[model samples]
Target: MTSTVDTVDPAAAEATEVSRVVISLLKGVVYQSESAQVWTLLRRFQARVTDHMTVMGLDLVIDEAEGYAHLRQATFDEANIPRLVPRHRLSFRVSLLLALLRKRLAEFDATSSDTRLIITRDQIAELLRVHLPDSSNEVRLIGDVDTLIGKVDELGFLRQVKGQEATFEVRRIIKAYIDAQWLADFDARLQAYLASMDGDGEPRG
Candidate 1:
């Protein structure tokens, strides 16, 4: 039996890892807490990755302080010759929840000195309850609200605290995705949603 010896080039191996990291970023946001490999690779190769993405009409948005990064389209333009990154369309209710969460986070940051904002499932429900239309079936409404919280959890904005199943730590990186401009638009959307909730007990428009 003959065995072949394969030699891997150090430079080529690193380039491959860097490329993988970049591709992963393209897929979605990369949090330093998610993987040590990705965080190391990103910190090392961010400049190269940014330049490469710039060619594709995408920008690398990195919050080194927060240790999270993601890609966004270079500009909001109607003339789309080709786009590498796709836009995310959130449901009206989800959008409202995110706005509320972001607002709560801001308030937490302003009032408290803690770096992390920890909140329970009940607290989150109460926060949303006021905004939602009155529903006769309390059980159904609470269950639906629980599902909404799961959606936010899946979106990476809220991380379940270690050893605490019912509590979550709100990641500050939310500010990057939902910015002031988006918040300004949120008020109008909220008003429309309230108007739509007149009879249905939930938003229709």
Candidate 2:
């Protein structure tokens, strides 16, 4: 004699899956490569997850081509509701580093066959150093650049390569933030910034 039992409920399982995916997205970005199972569940229950986010005044942003998903706050013009997400004001150094990286990523995409853009800490320092108005204190400048890189990493635009020293992979999500239009005027904007910094006689942050 054999005893067999089936106890799984389809509706409950699906509901649980959606909840899991929603929670994962709420926590932070869910990358297809980093979280394959969650990404699959998200794609499977995208509508459900989006519906849930909408209820919370949030929107689900997914880039299948880039294989990343995250949550954004929905705009409500008239509704007097407290925001679940906080807006962060990035410092000058962090912003500058991000712009440089975005420009580099664009150039890389145009010339290289590889999608992944890996850069070393020294390379990043050199990229920023050339644009700086002051370079008298090499040690201080390098330290400041490292700090800016750390900020970018915290913002999820740069990921450190495991088992590698001072190497990072530029996350493609940066493209979503710095669009094609931004890149079109990048050179002019960069020159303007440099001119302003030179006039100030001191680099700000």
Candidate 3:
């Protein structure tokens, strides 16, 4: 009896590795710090991965300085191609929270040498309190702040510090989405929002 052995081709094995990187990116944001090996593979096969994603009508966004990468829907006018990625509409309050966090990140980048910005729950609440409608119930106010924080966390911009209580590390990837232009535009609208506040500090429509 004769036995035959099949061996994997080197090219096929490399292609498989690249595919794994692409799959990881499709799932969600890939952080270099979280998976150094995967990140290396991504950089090694970026072009190939990008080509594969382009075929699916998606664009790969990578910020090397920030050490993060994610996929976004391509903006080209391809009406025939349906979107594989879904667009999420954030509530006004949640948008406001994101804007506030983005602004804080800018301020931190300017003054501090450290790349990571760690903030406490109380600090976030205090930062947002002025913009929010006044309330007599302290407990309710805390709950509201917690809810907003949760939303931000779910969006992948705020990561809770392990072994820490109510403390989070604001992910630097936020700078990619909320650029300087958007921040400036939002600042004007925020002033208008503040001006529209009623006697009780609630924004009046």
Candidate 4:
């Protein structure tokens, strides 16, 4: 006698289907359990996904150290039809600050320690002051830095550790966004910006 197979439960089947999509979303990225939305499909199957998305020629940029992930298209040679995504435009100041923060994080990673990457407000001020124009602009500069900091925090590039007003945890996701090649290209631009600053400049000193 042949046995009949029972139909799967509708709810259970739907959950399983969603789980597969979630796994695909997590490909090549380290997802933090706390940050991920509990109800979201991506959070459900994050653990089982590990494969990179190479078929569509996209690089899954994930910084497990920073707890963030984003998709970036893979670079293609001129001989191959170059597929490109629309690049988001960021203000020059914002871009500069992000680059500096990424550089600092890279430096922090090179050091041997389990200590978190921390930077003081004063340190950030100093870094930016050297690259910004000097005048009676100290107050304005501070405000500008504060704005940039807020923006970076919102973008998940920096996290303010509790009770640490002057310090912030620079997220590792910055490294993925600001890759080595981009930094190399911006080196000269940074140098030029630094050279534009006044010798007698002091940021709230």
Candidate 5:
């Protein structure tokens, strides 16, 4: 007995497959190449899907220099009531590190490109160590610094550059997150914090 399979149009089947793949990929955190693939698949569709996504309160942020993209919640308008997402509370150390990194970036922007922006691990340690309480526990201090570094890395504010355990790229995204207004408001507090650190004996050399 011969069996006959039901016939389906090849083009229709391909289109259906592409649609499914694109939708699955857009579930969360889409990058530029992924977005491009989605655009390719949905171009034939009537809806402006990207615009629709924006209307739904998501902003597609693309960093061409970094070659990455991700969706973020759009800032709420004063006219509309606020909607809150679960906030990630950073520790004091992490906050200090972020501020310092932003300040470093500002310094780089002011200086000429001919001068390389270089900050050593020791300098970072020194900058932070004073803020922390003085304890004979050397291991504990090192662990704290490591934890702070890990936190920054997770937030995409710092990228590990070449060299084992040394050197990191302070991502440009930091400037966006830590804006001028916040820095200006915190300047006096930061100055006091640094002065307090200076009052204490210098951090381990």
Candidate 6:
């Protein structure tokens, strides 16, 4: 039989895998776009990666079926490692839009026969409008909706479909982060938003 030492260096293999996983997550979310190489690496070394990142106060969120992975700050203690991944503070409107998109994605997953759920700008606008106060300025409302969509796109929850204008693919990470616990109180939250949106057609504290 061949000697194990000649066949593989266990220490070197672990180091290389750790480097690849860390570098990939540092760059941003790892989506299984064209290849599953990273997914394989992540699964094989997930424990080790978790151990390594936990020291820096970060945790990995990975979904095999969704084919994506990202890191989030694991702790908030002042004495801990400085938060490497800064938390994103979303405005109220932005938060509402994200919730709406996440709800739509859930609906699509339940009702659609197609494997993918893609929506046009108009569809998203229609979905949001029902929750908003009636506005006389239709154009301005649409523009605002477009701006919100752009913000979602920037946050990586919404992706513009290639070769299609005014269309987007709702990335699955939204569901991963927005848990069922959040959805459980979603209705009451929306009602509170409606209450907060003062009669002047603006949402305010």
Alpha-carbon RMSD of each model: 3.9, 2.7, 2.8, 7.2, 7.4, 4.1
Q: Looking at model 2, which ten-residue stretch has the lowest summed lDDT?
A: 196-205
Residues forming the 10-long window of minimal summed lDDT in candidate 3: 133-142
Candidates ranked by TM-score: 2, 3, 6, 1, 4, 5
By how many angstroms RMSD does model 2 differ from the true structure? 2.7
TM-score of each: 0.77, 0.88, 0.86, 0.60, 0.57, 0.84
| lDDT tens digits, residue span 68-150, model 3 | 99999998775777888787788656777789899999999899999899999999988777666555533454569888899
- Best candidate, TM-score: 2
Q: Model 1, 1-205: lDDT tens per residue?
A: 9999999999999899889988888778888877779978888887888898888888998888767888888875668558776666777667777898998887887798877889999988887777666666334556677777788887878888999978988877789988878776876877787777635355564
Q: Please give the range of 10 consecutive residues that has the lowest summed lDDT in model 4.
A: 43-52
Residue pairs whose backbone atoms clash in candidate 4: none
Q: Candidate 6's C-alpha lDDT?
A: 0.82
Per-residue lDDT of model 5, residues 125-164, tens digit only: 7756655555553345555776777788888777676774
- Local accuracy of candidate 4 as per-residue lDDT tens digits, 72-118: 66677754755543455776567778988888776777784754688
Residue-level lDDT of model 6, residues 25-128, one tens digit each, is 88778887644787788888899888888887888888777778999887665764677987789877788888888888888878987656799999988877
Model 4: residues with Cα > 4 Å off, grouped in runs: 1-59, 62-68, 73-87, 137-139, 192-205
Error of 4 at 60 (Å): 3.7
Tens digits of per-residue lDDT for model 2, 1-205: 9999989999999999998998898888899998999999999999999999999999899998888998888999967977887777885567778899999999998899987999999999998887776656545656777788888999989999999989999999898888989888988987776665533333555
Better of 4 and 6 by lDDT: 6
Task: Point out where model 2 deviates above 4 Å.
Answer: 1-6, 134-139, 198-205
For model 5 the local lDDT of residue 157 reads 75
Looking at candidate 3, what is the lDDT of residue 16? 92
CA lDDT, every prediction?
A: 0.79, 0.85, 0.85, 0.65, 0.60, 0.82
Residue 73 local lDDT, model 3: 92
- The ten-residue window of minimal lDDT in model 5 covers 196-205
- Backbone clashes under 3 angstroms, per model: 0, 0, 0, 0, 0, 1
Give the RMSD in angstroms, all C-alphas superposed, for model 3.
Answer: 2.8
